[model samples]
Target: MSERSAGLLLEARGVGKSFPGVRALQDMHLELRRGEVLALVGENGAGKSTLMKLLSGIYTADEGEFLLDGKPLQVSGPRDALEQGISIIHQEFNLMPDLTVAQNIFIGREPRAGRVFLADRALEAKAAELLDRLHLPLRPGQRVGDLTVAKQQMVEIAKALSYDARILIMDEPTAALNDAEVRVLHDLIRRFRTPDTAVIYISHRMDELKAISDRITVIRDGRYVETLDTATTTMPEVISRMVGREIAGGAGPEGVRDDRPVVLSVDRLSTKDLLNEVSFELREGEILGFAGLMGAGRTEVARALVGADPVASGTVSLRGKPVRITSPAEAAKHRIGYLSEDRKQLGLLLEQDVNANIGLSSVKERFQSFGFVRAKAMRARSRELVDALRIRTPSVDQTAKFLSGGNQQKVVIAKWLVKDCDVLIFDEPTRGIDVGAKEEIYRLLNDLAAQGKSIIMISSELPEVLRMSHRIVVMSEGRVTGQLAAAEATQESVMHLATLRPETETVR
Candidate 1:
């Protein structure tokens, strides 16, 4: 341990937890010293969330000792944790959209002038004070719904500060923030680092982790691996520890051929707020990448192309002719399918079985006859997909909600496959999945491309963009700033284009 036990602000010794068939955490140990940022890194489902719940009092440790300030910590609930000067900011903001910032911060513990009356002014005053202390440019009376995601996150931090929290836990804080917003958040975190405060940061972004963390603790498969000082440790070493192996990076555009004809073409595409005359061509069997920071219009392009969002003015050409796509169903008729980044909400029905989700897109054509459904055919076809994708499930009847994140993603892919879509748009395809599962998905994508599927992949992760893309289109401020053949694309060049503004030289 770099820090001494006597000065440790929080400590978890021999922590263990389990859910019904999953041992999420076992024999996990953590120590957080005063005035330090401790980064917690692991693959998805590696017990990072479980450990966080234990720390925040959402879940009790089945076996372990929690010590705070040199004493045994006894936290029975969230209230107890808060009272003990611990606060957790989840990935999703917990604030009610309709509520004002003041209302959200002091919701349950509101000040009252009398037993029967409320004190709105007092609440706003207190909230304003907290925000002001943090140097946040937000009004206490402002509705959380109206604020940008970055501003709303600031409100979450302000709420935590209201309790004079000594320990703070932030989970994927910059997942929704742009590059500029990320810098603002990093400044706030640095300001919050006091001799009396300890911070636990959980993130998957390697660059952010390296920039903000003092020490990194890696957890793999719910077990502690090792802790290293961020300044001294290399990224490869850290990744190796977290995933238990080196992640093999691919050579640019390997095995891609120029002879493949254009399968899809977008000409002068524009959306109301997001896209601005964006144009690109995807060749058959090509993986074209869209690289950008958040809100750079990467996802907007995907949505528009698939008819999930209306295009203000554009021409979409399949093969040699133009086609009008005004809805998702219409896009499907053109054989274009989209895999959303928020797969849980947009891609799959959690309550439905794998077979249902896989067969959903093609139900009319494959499983329906004379207004009647063919359950037996649906099951048979879905079973084939399950075997082909190597989706781990007891049977095709297993509910989507019960499957792991990776397997759920596979089911989403299966839906497109069943629809016989040759053009697929994958938005952040591997976003919350484990490393092993990521490799599987990569292989699956490669297989699809080899079979003549054209893919437009949108990703925020630069490394992922560089590794899998045959060609990359960099977007900035709703415009295509630059295009690069895979062999010439690097993190620096892609980011340079990604940060280029509308006022800058047009590179498209």
Candidate 2:
């Protein structure tokens, strides 16, 4: 389809939306044509979401209007937009846990067999057909809560399709998907797009956007930037536009004190279904990198080492002393800390205040044993971490949910620092962080290492694995494929090891 007005399927002009104090979208404009995949990109809270909400009718536009199929339309709510063939699959899913796949898909409008009675069998049969057609490998009768996160997401997609949506808004759909699962989702998206279907995909992974998008639309700070043909636009160019800089923060500091003593050592560590005789040493003043594909057991090893998950067998020693850790509390007692890759689920309690989350793990220690928490002392300590981490916030009392992605990460980092853990494990440390925040986080890691702290950082990005690691450990499935020093490692070498094994191997 051409870029001209006649070929366009959707035209959103001068669109704007606002919250209590924030003008979420200002003069935002977007265009999409038949059978085209448009990528919308920006840092978190950069008005990309607001624009999407307006399009999907989650929020009515404060100004301007959207024209769908040459006719101007008013969307009072999500249902209205859905009726107009607009469907949005959000980053955070909206699925009912207790509901079955079929129940969820046709929740508002279940088929009525006779006398206004629900036709459950027919609904399940129809949902099963959709699942089969989409290659979801799911049963209509299956409950959403019983399914994995990936499967639940599949249910969401099927539900959207059931709306007969022509314009599909996919907001970070692959964020929770593994590499193999991502491939499947990508294929499904491509297949689902008919001549009338216009897919708008929002993703942070530059590589995936390159693979899936036909056109790229970038927004920055509530303003429309530009739209470019995906084939003609490069990731660097897109990143430059997104951050308004040539910033690249995946590669952190290197060569962290080669002569320093090893602080954390895992000699043939084994965990059930995870670590398979994996062996690695973390130096006192080093950031050791772990590189592997998703579901390759990278986070599993981190969990086992941190005592979040139990080890089936093997040795985990701290500073040459053997330690028996069966629980996360025990791991903390040994001064070992782990930051989860999924901060929202496993790391931070989004509903709690900054000080509350920071002191959640070790409240008694941070606060004096006054029998009651020393509110004054806790505030001071939390503030110290907030300042040290450069957390962008108005006050320490702010809920983590209200904070930006970067600040929320800082709160997680602060929480661990209050524990004063000697060995720190950062799993996908900058997964969804912005460039500015990422650079700051990298520097923080460097500072921690310089302060004689041992770090084991697990990351999926190849550049990060090469740049920050004093020594790199490559894993495929559950086994360590190989280990190489910073001086000897390259992206291709690490990738080769990352894809070597199909089935999970034991690190111990």
Model 2 lDDT per residue over 1-508, tens place: 3348667899989988876555778898898988999999887667776788888888788899898876797888999999888999876678888999899988988888887899999988889888888777789999887665556778888888777889999887776565666788889889878888889998888888889999999998789999988998788899899888787545446565657888888888888776788888888888889888766678889889877777888898888888888877778888889898767777888888888999868876768675887888888989988888778666888778766565687889889989998989998787666555667788888888888888899876677668788888888878898888887788778777788874544222
lDDT of 1 by residue, 1-508 (tens): 3438778999999999976556878999998989999999887667787788788888888998899987899889888899888899876567888999999888898899999787999989988888877777789999998665557777887777677788989887776555666787788789888999989998877788889999999998789889999999988788889888788755645636778899999999998877899999999999999998766888889888888888899898999799888887888888899998767758999999898899977989889999999989999999998998777677898888766566788899889889888899998887655555677778888888989999999876788889899999999889999998888889999999998987787675
lDDT of each: 0.84, 0.81
Any idea what lDDT model 2 has?
0.81
Best candidate per lDDT, number?
1
Instruction: Return the lDDT, model 2, position 386.
Output: 86
How many clashes does each candidate structure show, in the order listed? Answer: 0, 11
Q: What stretches of model 1 exceed 4 Å from their correct place?
A: 1-4, 92-163, 254-258, 352-411, 503-505
Model 2 residue runs over 4 Å out of place are 1-5, 76-80, 95-163, 178-181, 248-258, 359-362, 367-395, 404-407, 502-508
Model 1: colliding residue pairs: none
Clashes of 1: 0
